[model samples]
Target: MTDKAKQYLELFLVFFKLGAFTFGGGYAMIPLIRNEVVSKRNWVEDEEFMEMLALAQSAPGPISLNTALFIGNKRMGFKGGLVSGIALIIPSFVIILIIAMFLVKFKENAVVERVFKGIRPAVVALIAAPLYMLGKSANVNKKNIWIPIVVVALVAFLSVSPIYIIIGSIVLGLLHFLYIKKIHKR
Candidate 1:
């Protein structure tokens, strides 16, 4: 095989492993993706990975797939994006297909119910671990720590839609950037 073909194969396998193993969705996959792309394979630097994550979250898709596409495009091109995305979904599609085939039959089984109950805490932990890591990556610190807390509260308690929160954050971020630029000019 040519070098490009081999590289594509490697990308497919890496994302396949990620999709097959990660639980609790994309958020839970963050750290693993970080480790793979940044630390292990040296595909992207830490800062670039974080930036890809930000864009991935902002886009209207599963963060994991979005991030994978970003990485693939960065590495190869549009075709790379297609390859990575298909690879990412294949394992998940197969698993979910299998589960759906028997879900109605097993949905009320005591053993299955207990298994799901036990998995809930594990899933939560999986999700939370990435939050802490991503917080650090995003440079969340004492002065800015309240931002996420407030956003979470607003969404969780007030029942505010996240679209508004995202829009508001974009405006605020641009305003902050302009303000800093003005100060730097002076």
Candidate 2:
């Protein structure tokens, strides 16, 4: 195969490993993905990963699939995205199929029940860790900091739908851009 093809294959393999090991879902995979793709391989930079994550969130489908597609495309091209997306999904699909069969066959097993119980808290912690990291990485300052707080309050207090949250964030982001533009003009 060509160098580009090799790169795409590597992307697929890495993500396949990630998909196989990750118990939870997209949120739990973020930190592990970052560690492997960003820190270990240097395939993507931290800022690029964050930006890609934002794009992935706005796009359709699962975040992990989107993430693999984004990074793979960034590295190799369209072919990379196709290969990586397929690779990331295949393991999860197979695992799920196996688990479904096993669950049907052994629904009453105490061992299986206890294993799932043990995994729940670890999955929660894994999800929480990335949230903490993302918060720490955010460029918080007096001017723009309140935007998140307000958005959170509106969501929590008013029970706003997530679509509204996306709309609100977009408007706020544009306003922040304008504010900075005005500051630069002055």
- Using TM-score as the measure, which candidate wins? 1
Those runs of model 2 whose alpha carbons end farther than 4 Å from true positions after fitting are 1-8, 23-64, 100-133, 140-149, 183-186
Each candidate structure's TM-score, on Cα atoms with residue i matched to residue i, is: 0.69, 0.60
Clashing pairs in 1: none
Error of 1 at 98 (Å): 1.7
Give the lDDT of residue 84 in candidate 2. Answer: 81
Whole-model lDDT per candidate: 0.91, 0.84
Q: How would you encode candidate 2's per-residue C-alpha lDDT over 5-108 as one tens digit per residue?
A: 67767888898998889977887898998998999999888998999899997787899889988887888788888888888889879978988888865857
lDDT of 1 at 119: 97
- Candidate 1: where are CA atoms >4 Å away? 1-14, 21-63, 74-76, 129-134
